[model samples]
Each structure stands twice: as C-alpha cells, then as structure tokens.
Target: MIVVQNLIDAISLGSVYALAALGIGLIFSIMRLINFAHGELIMVGGFVIYALAGNPMLVMALSAIIVVTILALGMERLAFRPLRKASPPTLLIASFAVSYFVQHVILMIFGSRPMGVDFLSVLGESFEFAGLRVPRLQCIAIVVTLALMVGLVVFFRASRIGVQMRAAAEDFTMARLLGVKADRVIAVAFALSGILASFVSLYLVAQTGTVSYKMGVNMVLIAFVASVIGGMGSLTGAALGGFIVGIVSVSLQAYLPEELRPYRDAFVFLLFIAFLLWRPQGLLVRRASERV
Candidate 1:
C-alpha cells in the first residue's frame, strides 16, 4: 500500500512535469529557442491567482491563463521577435536578460515572500481507493493534463492553425512560402506554452500549499532535463521522460540511504549524461521532416 501510494504521488508529480515540459518543448520546437523566462511566466500566473483572492474558481482559473498568455505574447513581441534574425547565441542571451528582468519586476511588485490560495474550497475534498488516499486537486491536475494533451493532439492533427504551426516548426521559410504566417504561429505557440505553465503552477501550488517567485526555477531545470532526455522537440518523448524522472526521483527519496538522499539530483543528472552519451539525439527523435 505504501508503494502504491508512492506511485500515485509520483504520477501526480510527473503529470505536472510533463505538462510544463510539453510547453517548453513546444516553444523550442516552434521558435527554435528556449525561453528562460518560462518559469517567471508560471510565477506570474500564480501571482495573478494570489492577487484575485476571493474570486470564483472559474474566474480565477481563466484569469490565471489569460495573464500568463498575455505575458508570453508580450515577451515574444518585445524581446524575441526583435531578436529573431539574430544569432541563436544572441537570442539565448536575450532570454536570460528577459528572465532576470521579469524576476526583478515581480520582486518589486509582490516582494520576495511566498503566497498561496485556498484551493480546498475550490477543489472540494479528497477520496480513497483501496488503501490509498488521493486529493481532489491531484485528480483535477491529472485529468486536466490528460485532457489538454489529447486536445493538442487533435488540434495539431485536424485544425488549420495547428497545421500552420506544424509547418512553421518544420521549416519556417517554406512555411512562409506556403502562406503560413510564421510569426503568428510562433506567437500562438508561446500562448499555448503560457497556458500550460499556468496549469502546472496551479497544481504545483495545490501540492505545496504555497508559491514563491523562485518556485519555478528548480522546476524549469527539472523540466528541461526531462525534455532533453525525452527528445527536445518531441512532446511524447517529453511526457515519457517526465514520468521516468518522477519515478526515479520518488524512488531515490523513498528508498535511498540517508547519506545519499541529498544526491538524488546528481543521480538524475548522471542519468541524463548517460542518455546524451548513448543517444545524443534523445531516446525518441522526431524526424527532421516531421513538423511536430
């Protein structure tokens, strides 16, 4: 029963990681650049929820998504779009600058203290299955993540805008020639990423019962590692990698010697290194010809 409980915990945690990683991977695949400020976007979503303390649950959720989505769109327009023609290194440096700027701006507004929401009332209560107990928030997170993933799959497969986005990711110039608005598609990708970040932040706050400006920093690292292990541009790979990392992390924390607990991250890093050495292209590779 303890093992079952641990597995459940790990799956819930992994679902959050997978959602975050999907966003990261989507933006990377589309724009061919990493958004270092992604974590701050998640932070912004949490802050939005915090600011709107007593609103209805639906209102709070929609506001969180909108705030982050607008922030992401604005970031692309002000920062990334201008640097689009620049070298990859230049764009990467700009991402770092944007990240720091957002972090400091958040500090100026909300200070460095942690904040939290009363989700118990909104999410209702917990329930038990067999000998294992599960929180309503966890179930919500899992269901929402799965739903979003399925929706994305359908969108990419059936929707015109999704086709354009996929085409843009495959070959920007060619997609442009084919009458796809590369810029618009990239912006939409960022918007979608922001939404994913908001969902991730929501569940993370529920799990931890609080939020900090720096909450997403470590999470971004973990998600990035998962993305790399899964396959940089492969959404499926990212999800698989997240579950693998979650299992490994939980197992290490639960079963490793006390002296080795602190080295859990190191062990994960070693695994990443091994994956890179063994398959630099990642465990699963999206063919160059494949758009998404």
Candidate 2:
C-alpha cells in the first residue's frame, strides 16, 4: 500500500512536469528557442488567480487562461518575433532577458514575499481506495495530463493549424514556403504553451497553498531538463522524460537516508548524466533535418 501510494504521488508530480515539458517542447519544436520566460507565464497565471481569489472557480480558471495566453502571445510578438532571424545564442539571451524582466516586474507589483492562496482547496483532500491512499489532486493531475495528451494528438492529426505547426516543427522554412503562415503557427504555439502554464499554475497553487514569483523557476528548469532528456522536439519523449524524472525523484526521497535527502537533486543530475552518456540523442530522437 505504501508503495502504491508513492507511485500515485510520483505519477501526479510527473503529470505536472509532463504538462510543463509539453508546453516547452512545443515551442522548441518550432522556434529552436527555449523560452526561460515560460515560467513567468505560470507565475503570471498564479498572480491572476491570486488577484481573482474568492471568485467563481470557473471564472478564475478562465481568466487565468485568457490572461496568460494573451501575455504569451504578447511575448512572442514583442520580444521574440523581431529576433526570429537571430542566432540561437542571441535568442537564448533574449529569453533570459525576458525571464528576468518579467520576474522583476512581478516582484515590484506583488512584492518579494510569498502570498498564501487557497485556490482549489478541495483538491488538497485525500482518499483511500484499494488499500491505497491517494491525493485527489494527483488523480486529477493524471487524468488531466492524459486528456491533454490525447487532445494534442487529435489536434495535430486533424486540425489544419495543427498540421501546419507539425510541418513547421519539421522544417520551418519549407513549411512557410509551402504556405504555412509562420506567424500564425508560432503564435498558436505560444498560446498553447500559455494555456498549459495556467493549468500548471492552478495545480501548483493548490499543492503549495502559496504563490511566489520564483515558484515557476525550478519547475520550469526541471521541465526543461525533462524536455531535453525526452528529446528536445519530441512531445511524447518529453512526457516520458517527465515520468522518468518523477519516478527517480520520488524513489530517491523514499529510499535515501534522511541525512542524504538534501542532496537528492545532485543524485538526480548524476543519473541524468549517466542517462545522457548512454543515450544522448534522448529517448526519442528528432528528425535530422535542419530546423530553419
């Protein structure tokens, strides 16, 4: 039962990371730029939820999604689109600039301290079934992750924009030459990423019961690593990498001595190194074609 419970917790955590990685992976697929500021979208959504606290649950959720999506679109238009033709390192630096700028802007408005938030209190509850205890949020997280993954698959397979996005991911210059609107596809990618960030915000606030400007930073970092481990441009690989990380993290916490628990992340990274040494191309390798 204890093992089962731990598995549930790990899966829930992985689901959250998987959602985050999918958001990052989608954008990287098209842009080849890792937006460190992606975390700010999650942070912004948290603040939106915090600001709208006590409103109807549905209202708060919709508002967060809308606001975050708009900001994501704005980020692409204002910060990234102009540099679309820049070198990879230049784009990376721009992402870092956007990350720091937004984080500080949030700090100025919300202050540096963490603020308690009671969004989705019910998800904090836990239950027992089949002799195993499980968190409601964990169950919901798993379900939501599965649904989103399925929905994305369907969207990519059926929708015209989705096909264009996939084509853009494969080879952006060719896709645009084939009449895929680069702006529309890239904008849609950011919008979708923002939507994912909002959900990440809700789950995080519910789990932590507090909102901090830096809350999304560590998660985004982990999600980025997960994306890399799974294969930079492979959404399915990113999801798998997230689960692998969650499982490894949870198992280390469970098995490590109390004195060594503080070094768990060091151990995780060590393992990551080992994994990379074994399969540097990642679990799912992207096509060899040039991105642009």
Candidate 3:
C-alpha cells in the first residue's frame, strides 16, 4: 500500500513536470530557444489567482490564462523577435536576462513572502478506498495530464495550424519558404505554452498550498533538464524523461536512509550525469533529417 501510494505521488509529480516540459519543447522545436522565462508564466498565473482572492473558479482560470498568454506573446515580440537571427548563445543569454528581470519584478512588487493559495482547497483532500490511501490531487492531476496530452496529440495531428507548427518544428526556414506562416505558428506555440503554465500554476498551488515567485523556478529547472534528457526537440521524449525524473526523485525521498535524505538531489544529478555520458542524444529523438 505504501509503495502504491508512492507510485501515485510520483506519477502525479511527473505529470506536472511533463506538462511543463511540453511547453518548453514546443517553443524550442520551432524557435530553438529555451525560454527560461517560461517559469514566469507559471508565476504570473499563480499570482493572478492570488490577486483575485475568491473569484469564480472558471473565470479566474480563463483570466489568468489570457494574462499569461499575452505576456508570453509580448516576450516573444519585445525580447526575442529582434534577436531572431542571433546565435543560440545570445538567445540563451537574453532568456537569462528575461528570467532575472521578471523574477526581480515580482519580488519587488510582491516582496519575498509566499502568498497563500487557499483556493481549490478540495483538491488538498486525501481519501482511502480498498485500504489504499491516495490524494485527490494526485488522481486529478493524472487524469488532467492524460486528457491534455491526448488533446494536444489530436490538435497537432488534425488542425491546420498544428500541421504548420509541426512543419516549422522540422525546419523553420523551409517551412516558411513553403508558405507556412512563421509568426502565426510561433505565436500559437507561445500561447499553448502559457496555457500549460497556467495549468502548472493550478496544480502547483494545489500541491503546495502557497505561491511564491520562486515556485516556478525550480519546477521549470526540472522541466528544462527533462527536455534535454528526453531529446531537446522531442515532445514524447520530454514527457517520458519527466516521468523518470519524478519517479527517481520520489523514490529517493521515500527509500533513502533518513540521514542521506538531504542529499537526494545529489543522487538525482548523479543519474543525470550517467544519462549524459551514456545517451546524450536522449531517450528518444527525431531522425536527423526530421529534427530542427
């Protein structure tokens, strides 16, 4: 029973990470830029919820999504667009600047204190059935993640914009030359990323019961690593890598000797190093011809 519970918790956490990586993977696929400011979208959504106090759940969610999406679009426009032709190192450095700027902005306004995420209190409940204990949030997180993943797959497979995005992911310059609209696809990518960030915001708040500017930082850090491990441009690989990271993290916490628990992260990074040495191309990758 304890083992089952740990598995459930690990899957829940992995689903959260996978969603985050999907966002990063989406933009990187098309633009080849890793937006470290992705975490800011999560932070913005959570803070929106905090600012709204006790608004209707659906209303709060949509409003927050819109706010985050606009900011994401603005980021691409104001910060990234001008540097479209720049080197990867330059884009990455700009992203770092964007991340620090946003984090400090939030810190300046909200201060360093963590805000209470008392909304969505019901997900915080736990239950037992058939002698098995489980968190409601865990169950909900898994279901939501599965549904969102399926929906995304369908969107990419069936929608016109989705096709263009996939084409862009394969080779942005070629896609544009083929008459696919670059701006539209990239905008949609950022919009989808923002939506995922909002979902992460909700799930994180449910899990932690508090919102801090730093909250998204660590989660996005994990997502970024998972993206690399899974293959930088492979969405499916990113998802799989996220699950592995989450499982390893939870397993270490659950089974580690208490005295060594503080070093769990060190162990996780050791695993990361092993992956780097063994399969730096990642667990899954598109054919060289298909990759961006």
lDDT of 1 by residue, 108-224 (tens): 998998876765354647788798888787787778888999999998989999988777767777878788886788889989999999998777765676778898888888888
Number of colliding residue pairs in each model = 0, 0, 0
Candidate 2, residues 54-166: lDDT per residue as tens digits? Answer: 99988888999999999999999999999998988999999999999999999999999999978889987888779887878888889989998999999999999999988
Question: Which residue window of length 10 is worst by lDDT in model 2?
Answer: 283-292
Q: Ten residues in a row with the worst lDDT in model 1?
A: 283-292
Write one digit per residue (lDDT tens) for candidate 3, span 1-292: 8898889889988999999999888888888899899998999888888888688877777788889889899888899888888888898899889888988998998999998867678877788897777888888889999999999999999999998888888888788889988778888998899888888988887678788989889888999888989998888988888888999999999999999999998999898999999999888886432323
**Could you say which candidate leads in TM-score?**
2
Better of 1 and 3 by TM-score: 3
Model 3 clashes, total count: 0
Global lDDT of model 2: 0.90
Pairs that clash in candidate 2: none
Best of the two (1, 3) by lDDT: 3
The segments of candidate 1 whose C-alpha lies over 4 angstroms from its true place after superposition are 121-125, 288-292
Models sorted by lDDT, best on top:
2, 3, 1
Error of 3 at 85 (Å): 0.9
Task: Give the range of the ten consecutive residues with the poorest summed lDDT in model 3.
Answer: 283-292
Q: Candidate 2: where is the Cα deviation over 4 Å?
A: 288-292
Model 1: how far residue 48 lies from native, Å: 0.6
Q: Which pairs clash (backbone N, Cα, C closer than 3 Å) in model 1? A: none
